[model samples]
Target: MTEVRCPLCKTVPEHGRKWDYGERTTVQCAVCGFYTITGTAVSIAERQNISHKLSAYTRDNTERGVDVPEINSNNLSQLQTSLPDYGVGDKQLLYMRALERRSKFPGSLVQVTPGIDYPLAWASGEEEFLYLLRDLLSRRLVAVPEGGTKALREDVSFETLITPAGWEYLEKHRAVSAISDQVFVAMSFSPNLQAAWEDAIRPAIVESGYKPYRIDDEPHVDRIDSKIIAEIRNSGFLVADVTEQRPGVYFEAGFALGLGLKVFWCVRSDDLEHVHFDTRQYNHIVWETEADLKEKLFYFVTSVAGKRTAT
Candidate 1:
């Protein structure tokens, strides 16, 4: 191991290390965490000036306790394209969540170094990170000890703690029924797709230990649109199949995403070309047949959402 500047953030972290293996370089960076980058990916990132976004992407994944990622040529384009564009409010909320995760207990001080940990909230750089931190402090969502701000201003490590209000804010914004046994299905109700629903989508959710609910399958006195919203809120996650290019399905999926609920995208092989340009960047499960959809959906539910616990 040798000291070197992080290929993603271009920062020479005091504790960072690098290892070379032929065409790839594995780096352990204070800002971006552990990731390996191929030579081609390095060039692309630099050329596109997306190194900051890539750093944040890697850091966010690392903070979630996932395996170290390899930013290679094959997936770099998709990875960069799929990166979420968070709004200012969302960025503030994300920063608070990061602080919450780092805190071992209530009121536990978290050591934050703007120069080293700016990617924790997807901030473009230290200046943006400090701006967000100051906003949190002004709102009384976080507290810094005396002189801590001075250290922070100097681009050094400063200890700050999440306030009680911050915890409440997170709780209010948390996704509903994250562990519910219900999985919502948003897809076209065409008779031709009945087999796909019955043999594929429904069976996949059931086999994964979750109850599948399609809004049209059950009768309700409420308006259909209102009912759909209610059911989606109660669901643990949603499976959106855009095989028919239905506008309603897209709306429902977008609504779920706005609520921070996971929405797995899927499309029939024949209809893949019709998927909207806006959502095309998502990694959709393209299926040629009902059986293939079932197998793939089942695996995705178990691996990404986790197999539901038995009652």
Candidate 2:
């Protein structure tokens, strides 16, 4: 039989499974802990065609298989017979990274610090992220500090450390690693272009599922070059706006390209001729307005850097 694959991680379900209802089909993948429900056809005639349009919306008609609640031990038991076979999905990879950082500390512990560590481990605040944390607790892969309970809730803040079982699991089952989804914006921070960068470019990058960072966004006192290099090194890709023919943007793009990082070259339509001759051969996103820039950049990043998340 053909292996049933997960839509998220592209891993086959260990336990061959399927659940079919007349109007809906719910499928759970044991490999990546992915569960999704899709529309189903009731009869042979109905199965021949099915289409949903915006006009079909009704306040009384509730959506099914869409809400992801905070998953606890009880929830896990209902979903599967056992813990997932491997740590391959986004949450598992993040938890592994947080634990790895904790292991480097004097004591094997990670504090629940927002923006620094927590954001890395958990993907901000959402039911899905809380569910992942709870899943880890249920699996005995991690535990909180002395006074705290093994189960963690969304509101709680405490130090956590990976258990022995977690380490063993990591050694055996970890195959995919998380890539830094930071997209460094390299451009001339001119007063005139501030609105365009902030409103258009930055928001577009964020919508494309990557954190956008610029030198001005940081309040550090470090040397400018050092900060640029460090950010570039940590970033999965760079978006360099070469408008106005800024030397710094070119330098940053060159450094990033030399380091084998993907660079999305962009320019204002009027400034196209001003781009340096050496880099002119590269594909550039030329835009006339902010709306155009936002739309085009989002498409470019999604197409070029979409697979970075799977790494």
Candidate 3:
């Protein structure tokens, strides 16, 4: 196997391999947040610089008797046309960009004031911003007080230190730059809840011009974790219902949060009290019937996610 390295940090990411998309050969390094675009349109100097660096690194390591794998030179021209589109979620993107902008000083940690004037809050509405913040905190991407990890409702100042996983995931998912068109729906597939998802949740997502996806819809495989991660990796946002209080649904929602994906939580009135204590701090839509879900979900998408209203 060829070993590709991040040009900026020289780290080899697991997903660092370049894939072809039409006229471009792109590489996203989750380790260093480096997204590379190369092809006929690339400048000769840039190409030469990368090639020279790789060659020099390889030669130096080889002379030192280090077992270094070389990047496959032959694969440069081979294009993988069937590669899936992997993009960063909008809310995740906003939070990351804000972090980058806010942490511009000469330090690994920074204190950010959360409010309308904040960078993250500026790009996103209040509700969405709070949800994204909770997601980041839950994922441990940013450090916060042990008890302060609950969903932020007020404008409070908090200290944040970026974690290694956060940096790599942000880079790998292209979270700071890419905009995705995928929405993941996480809910129990019980017979009674089928109508709610099809009529309310999925349709609301469709109206936002993003494709809605569910785990059960994916082909079942042995490793369910891998499939769930892959689908989240390819999605821009998530919607989860904790009505059933299923462990799998909670896991899915947590995974998405760790990845900094926007998640909308909802539950049936009777089931609301059954929701996990940790997640109870966040605001959840309490709906009685499918029609109520549809109306509320539409409003949620339009107001928080900024769905396009038809002119």
Candidate 4:
């Protein structure tokens, strides 16, 4: 195997490997992990100078052990737009979540190499990752060995443990619906939109390995508002289709967001102009046909929530 510069970060990873198969190249880099990139995407990334962001995106996903991301010209722009804009606090929380995921049990020691694991926090580099670790240490949310901090500062690998306080913090901040396999659908219930629900929304959720729960789908004796609230609380995430500019959809989507549950927004292409002004800024999957909505929604669900494990 010959040394090859990582197409995304332009750095030669010490443990990286590259394999060329006709038009696409598969690269496994210390920074970007494993990803396959098409010839067109490599050129586009260079021309747009978005390699750093792309590297972080790929690295983050790779760390999560999800489907290996393929960067092709068709989806490169969309992927760039979907890259998270994590703030300092968000990054800290993300880092903590990463640590929690790696641990087999509470207080288990998790080894980390900042240089390679920085992207787990969506951090720009090792410096920012160390800054986050320092903050966690200061807050006593995580504990290192007596001299582990100094070793980490020197860019040495070390195992850090999440303290009891860290467990408590995560428990408090964790989403109530994190364990659920149900995805709530908040959309217009008009007769005109029935086909959209049956043909696109429901099928997409099922194909993504999650149950779709819409208010009208199940019989309930409770008041509509009460049942809606209860079901939303039990949902893992939400799909809010604002095709008819429904006020209830907006309220439900907002409620889910307040609970820290992910909400995917959607709107019919023709109804795009009528979406509420406040939510206009959010990226919405605008679809011209049911087929388009089904495809996009399935992709979004699998990308964000990941496919549920089969029993």
* Residues 1-311, model 3: lDDT tens digits: 46765443344756666654454333444322333444442344245444322322233233334443223332222211111322224556546655765575523666655543222332223454566667777787766645545534546756676666777766765531245567778899898899988888888878876678887874553356655765775677788998888898889889878766778899998898899999998789899988898888878866776774443
Q: What is the clash tally of candidate 2?
A: 1
| TM-scores for all predictions | 0.59, 0.44, 0.49, 0.57
- Identify the leading candidate in terms of lDDT: 1
- What does candidate 1's lDDT look like per residue over 88-189, in tens digits? 666788788888888999989999888887887788899998988899899999999887777867368889998899898888657433435788899999
Q: lDDT per model, in order?
A: 0.83, 0.59, 0.60, 0.82
**What does the lDDT read for residue 294 in candidate 3?**
81
Poorest lDDT segment (10 consecutive residues) of candidate 4: 171-180
lDDT of 3: 0.60
- Local accuracy of candidate 4 as per-residue lDDT tens digits, 228-286: 76577568799999998889999999988976788999999999999899998889999
Top candidate on TM-score is 1
Candidate order by lDDT, decreasing, is 1, 4, 3, 2
lDDT: which is higher, 1 or 4?
A: 1
* Model 1, residue 151: C-alpha shift (Å): 2.8
Report the poorest 10 consecutive residues by lDDT, candidate 3: 74-83
* Global lDDT of model 4: 0.82
Q: How many clashes in each structure?
A: 0, 1, 2, 0
